[model samples]
Target: MGEVEIRPPRPEEYAVAGEVTVLAYQADGHLADGVGYDATLRDVARRVEAAEVLVAVDRAGDVVGTVTIVQPGSEYAEISRPGELEFRMLAVAPSARGRGIGDALVGAVFDRARALGLRRVVLSSLDRMHSAHRLYERLGFARLAERDWRPFPHVMLIAYQIDV
Candidate 1:
C-alpha cells in the first residue's frame, strides 16, 4: 500500500464504475442492468473532473470508494426541497471496507459542499446495509425517512440527510 490517490476519474475509467457498483452491492444480489453505457461513463468522468464526484483509488489504481454530489439541478436529484445537494452514491468496494475510506469520502463531500455554497445533503440506502447506517450516523448524517420503492419487491430503503 503506497500513497492513496483521490482524484477525478477519466472517461475510460467508467467501465470500472459498473464493475464497482456490481461488486459493492453484490451482498444484496444486485447486478448491473445494462444502464452503464459508454455515455454514462463519460458523464461520470466529466462530473468527477468538475468536483461533482469524489473517488478513492488505491495506489495501484483500483477504484475502492466513490461518492457523487449533485447540485439542485442534476438529474439524479429527486429531492424537490430547496437548497439541497443530493449525495447520489457513496459506495466503498467490499474489499476496501473497515479502512475509514467511507469516512474520508464523506469528509470530501463536506468540504465540497462548503465550497459550492450548499448547506444540505441527502442520500438513499437500503435498510439491509446496516453497517452503512452505522457509518452515516457516525459521520453526523441523521435519519430523515425510510420507504420501499424502485427496482424490486421487499427492498426496504432509508433516506439520510445532513447539514454540511
Candidate 2:
C-alpha cells in the first residue's frame, strides 16, 4: 500500500531480512523445519558477503522481500555461466505478496546484468514452485531443460535463462 524501494540490505537489517526470507519460504510451503536448505535461506549475512543481497522495503522501511544475485565464479553461484548472471533465494513476505515486490527484485537483477554487460540472467527453481515459474516466464525467461539438475535425491532443480 506504500512505495517500495529495492536496494541492498544495510548491515543492521540483515537479521530482519533473513527472518522475512524464512517466514516467506515457510508460509509458502517452500521450506521444511530442520532442513539444511532452510538454513541456507535464512543466512542473509552469508549471502550479503558472498553475493549481492537485495531487499524490497515498503514506505515504512520494513523489508518485504529479498533476493540474492550471484555473479559467475562467486561462491554462491549455482547456475550462472561465463557472460551470465544468476540469482537465487527470491522471497517475498507472505503479507507482501501480489504487490510486485518479487518482480521489482528480479528486475533489479536484470538491471544489474545489463549494467555489467552480461548476456543473460539465469536461475534455478524447484519444480513445485509453479508461481515463481510463471513470473519467470512473464519476464521472458525460457526453460533451459538441458541444464536442469538435481542436487539431492528426488529433488530436481529446473533451470531458466533470459537474454538481457
Candidate 3:
C-alpha cells in the first residue's frame, strides 16, 4: 500500500469519489435491495453542498475511500443532536480494502469533530456490515442499538457512537 492522505477532496475529484463510494457499497452487497440508494451515494457534489466530504487519496492521487461528516443540523445528519457530529456514507474502494484507508478516513472525521469543538460522533451502518462493525469497535465506537432505524422497508441501519 502507498502513503494515503485523508483530506477534503478537490472539486474535480467529486465524481471519482462518488463512483468509488457507489462501487464500494455495491461490492459489499449493501446495494442488493434495489432501493435507489445508489443515487444518494453517487451525489458527492450534493453532499459537499451540505457537509464535509473527505477522501482517502493514495500517492498516485487517486481517491480510494470517502466519507461525509455531517454537522448536527446538516441535511445528512440523521441521528445527531446539538454538540454531536455525525458521519455518513463511509466507503473504501474494493481494491483498497485492508489497507487502513477506512480507518484513516474515519480518523479524519474525529479530527474534524474536535476541530468543531464537538466531543461526540455518531454514525449509522448496515446491520450486515460485520467487518465495519469490527472496525468501529476497534475505534472505540459503541453500538447505539436504541437508535437503530429503518429508512426503507428493505434496509435497517444500525447506530454507533464514540466520544472524542
Candidate 4:
C-alpha cells in the first residue's frame, strides 16, 4: 500500500525477480501442467541478458513483479513487427495483485516504447488470463485476433496491440 518503483532489476535482484515470476505463475495455476514453462519463467537472468527486464519494487525495496521488453528484432520477440515494441513474461507477486503494480509495470513499457520512438507496443497473453486481458484493455490495448498464435500444441497465445 505504498509507492511502487518500476525499474530495471539490479544484478543481485535478478534471482529475486525470477522467483517472484515463478511464484506468481504457480500461484495463478499457470504451471499446473508440470510443463517446462516453469524453467522459462524462472530464467530472469537469460531474459535480462537478452532484453530489458523491468521490475516493480515496493516501498521496502522488495521486488514484487517483473516484465521483459524486447526490441523489434530481439531473439525474444515473437509477434512484433518493425516499428513495434514487444513485451513478455509479465508477472506480479500473488500478494501484490490488485495493487496497481501490473499497471505500473505496463506503463513503464509504454514509456520505454515512446522513448524509443516506436509507433506501437504489442504483447501476447495466455487465453485464460482474463484479469490481464482486462488490464490490457483498460490500458487501451486491442485484441488482434489474426495475430493470435499457438507456439505449442493445445496452447493458444492471444495477441494484443496498442498504438503508442
Cα lDDT of all candidates, in order? Answer: 0.68, 0.90, 0.92, 0.91
Indicate whether candidate 2 or candidate 4 has the larger lDDT: 4
Query: By descending lDDT, how would the candidates be arranged?
Result: 3, 4, 2, 1
Cα lDDT of model 4 by residue, 20-47, tens digit: 9999888877776656898988888889
Name the best candidate (by lDDT): 3
**How should the candidates be ordered by TM-score, best one leading?**
3, 4, 2, 1
Model 2, global lDDT: 0.90
lDDT of 2 by residue, 42-160 (tens): 88999988999999999998999999999988999888899999999999999989988988999999999999999899999988889999999998999998989988776889999
Error of 2 at 20 (Å): 1.2
Query: In candidate 2, residue 55 scores what lDDT?
Result: 95
- Candidate 1: clashing pairs of residues: none
What is the clash count of model 4?
A: 0
Candidate 1 — worst ten consecutive residues by lDDT sum?
29-38
The count of residue-pair clashes in candidate 3 stands at 0
In model 4, where is the ten-residue run with the lowest total lDDT? 26-35
Which run of 10 residues does model 3 get worst, by summed lDDT? 1-10
Candidate 2 clashing pairs, residues 3+ apart or interchain:
none
Against the hidden true structure, what lDDT does model 1 obtain? 0.68
Q: Which consecutive 10 residues in model 2 have the weakest lDDT in total?
A: 27-36
